[model samples]
Target: MSRNWTERDIPSQRGRVAVITGANTGLGFDTAKALAERGATVVLAVRDAEKGKKAAAKLGANADVTVQELDLAALDSVRAAAADLRGTLPKIDLLINNAGVMYPPRQTTREGFELQFGTNHLGHFAFTGLLLDLLLPVEGSRVVTVASIAHRIRAAIHFDDLQWENSYDRVAAYGQAKLANLMFSYELQRRLAPRGTTAAVAAHPGVARTELMRNSPAVVRAVFPAVAPLFTQSSERGALPILRAATDPAALGGQYYGPDGLGGYRGRPQVVASSPQSYDVAVQRRLWTVSEELTGVKFPVG
Candidate 1:
């Protein structure tokens, strides 16, 4: 509960098996790198094999790491990767759903769903469900879903138009996706509590300098790039909340972590609360059901 929780506070991860999506760059890379250094066998589940390999290599020669292709934008790819992971790993101590897309041009995923919603929320939703069995049997297992401060913006489930077929606002869509991430974590935690086999927690990078911002608008692109270093934290620092949510002994299920600085833009990791909208039980359950229906990947647990 200290104010200055850093990566050094992460407990020894020896013998643990971790699967981190989008581990090739940004917060995911730093998260995977830190865990691998702490002795966890990490699988950098990425969309590109070459990038994953390069990322693995960056962790140094001795880090127990490997690459698994996981393209969250595609449902078939998510299923295939999950199946492969289940067959290979006997147990998973940590499953970090850290991959996401920011404010990009209007596009649909392979399934014809909105790109950000599909990749950021639905993709991880399906992947986690497919692999929940692996974590369900392991004691102390944790599922860390990476959300964002954007969830507090113009976010809603948008059930009537989940794909934004009629209209699209990049920032609003991104907010919906991020909001769904937090909702998924809370709902998953509720389901996991009874089984006592795993915990679901959420963390945010707190405005760190990462490649996820490549989709920013023209004005933001011009100004953000120049001002980022002065205001934003490094990706390494951004990964702290994630690492903390994954390894902090005192961290509880359904809890959220982010930077403790003013407006949560940058600082050390600490337990932080999400928007009240994120905790809406009705919306959470509805989204869960809708996600399962869309992905056809029902979790083994209730």
Candidate 2:
């Protein structure tokens, strides 16, 4: 019902502290750039410190930007990053879970969990839980997770074989992970509601042309070059939804944002609905429990 939202709509983030993962490139980088431009103290939590520093440099010396090493694929790295952040930052305004893998060959993470689920869902679950104390004390602080449109296609939590050990389907696995992201956001919102300090939100880029596609299927990659202009939006445009979710004062907990075009492929960012399945509360709780058990991380809320 509201007019189309753009980065220009983002309120000034002066004095706010935002930490975004995978900020070296693509949607994450764009999100960071927009926030920095608006005067937010931005921290690029990336796997490669050098790349993050390079990315921060592009934001210019005026932008208060820093880099922290984080590798979502490894739980140890996630723990170390969280501990380091807790020690440095007294409070956090935004925690954007933006880094993720997509459609990579069937592989396992350092902890032997499926790569997609481990890095995309469980890793974030642990990281957010570990850093939630800082966010819980900061009013208006938010935990925004970047989900995907793939969540509606071929996605279902395979509880029995969550690791994809029995079989592997790249698309399905990716869908499952994204779906988990959405569910996690929703569940987290419900948990954070009592205190009313921090909000949990989700957003999707909606077919943005970004480096995330480097691991996509060969067929998609081969044809992407030709169809990208026609079907996909630029990384900056794609990041609008995420930016809105992170900075929009009107945005509430449990909200999801994405493109407002045909099939949600492209256009301006707007509040959008995720797949019906993503709203399954029972499944969300189950996933949360399992995630804690697997990651050995517990949240202070709920």
Candidate 3:
């Protein structure tokens, strides 16, 4: 329940392994760095190979960090990265589904799925299932998927038109994806329970300074000039809930953590509640089925 996670809280991670997606920058980068500093061998899965390498190099604080190319929006890249990691490491203590795309000009993934839903939710869903085996044998392992307050922006998943092809609304699609993250987290906690108390927690960065906001219209970015200081928090601070969910003994399944401030905007991390619709079971199952099909991956790990 404690929100704070200093170095002492992580314990010695000598033999453990961690895989973090989109770790080339933003909260993912900070999370990877923090874990690696605690001795967890952290894999930086990123879309750009060059940026990934630079990210690992910048993490001079953590010697165990490595860069691997992973394009979350591209199903092929996701599968290849998982296969490559499986080839190298047999077990992983933490799997942080951290990388995500946000409000971009209406786009589609390499597989043609809506960009936000594809990368932020479906991609991570498949990635975790493919890598589920890597964590089953590790004692007290976990997976943390990043969701957002934007979940409140929309109450439920649009099963009728999940791809937003029928009617594409950028903000709506983003909210749906973030909500999928929470639903997937809870559903995964159920799946991972038999794997020995492995947690499937969800966290949000509370409007941190990340490139996720990039590609937003100029007027959107302009808002950052005045109210920015109040609305935004640093990526390092935003990473606490994720690090805590991954390493904190007190963290449990189905919990939502985010900054504790105005509308859960900017402060320390704490257990929080997401929109009520996030707990819909049928929606969770539907999303999972769609994800497996989209990614051409299977669950039921060894």
> Highest lDDT: which candidate?
2
lDDT value, candidate 2, whole model? 0.95
Mark the regions of model 1 whose C-alpha exceeds 4 Å error after superposition: none
Model 2 scores worst on lDDT over the 10 consecutive residues at 1-10
Model with the higher TM-score, candidate 1 or 3: 1
lDDT tens digits by residue: candidate 2, 1-302: 35677888899999999999999999999999999999999999999999999999999999999999999989999999999999999899999999999999999999999999999999899999999999998999999999999999899999999999999999999999999999999999999999999999999999998888989888998999999888899999999999999999999999999999988999888899999899999999999999999999999999
**Better-scoring candidate (lDDT), 1 or 3:** 1
lDDT of 3 by residue, 50-142 (tens): 999999999885378888898888878888988999999889888999988888878899888899999999889888987888887777888
Query: Model 2: C-alpha RMSD to truth?
Result: 0.9
Score residue 27 of candidate 3 by CA lDDT. Answer: 93
Kindly provide the TM-score of model 2 when superposed on the true structure, using C-alpha atoms.
0.98
Please provide, for model 1 over 1-302, each residue's C-alpha lDDT reduced to its tens digit, 9 standing for 90 to 100.
87878888988999999999999999999999999999999999999999999998899999999999999999999999999998899999999999999999999999999999999999999999999999988999999999999998898889999999999999999999999999999999999999987999999989999898888998988999688876689999999999999999999998999999888889989999899889899999999999999999898877
All candidates: TM-score = 0.98, 0.98, 0.94
Query: What's the C-alpha lDDT at position 207 in model 3?
Result: 83
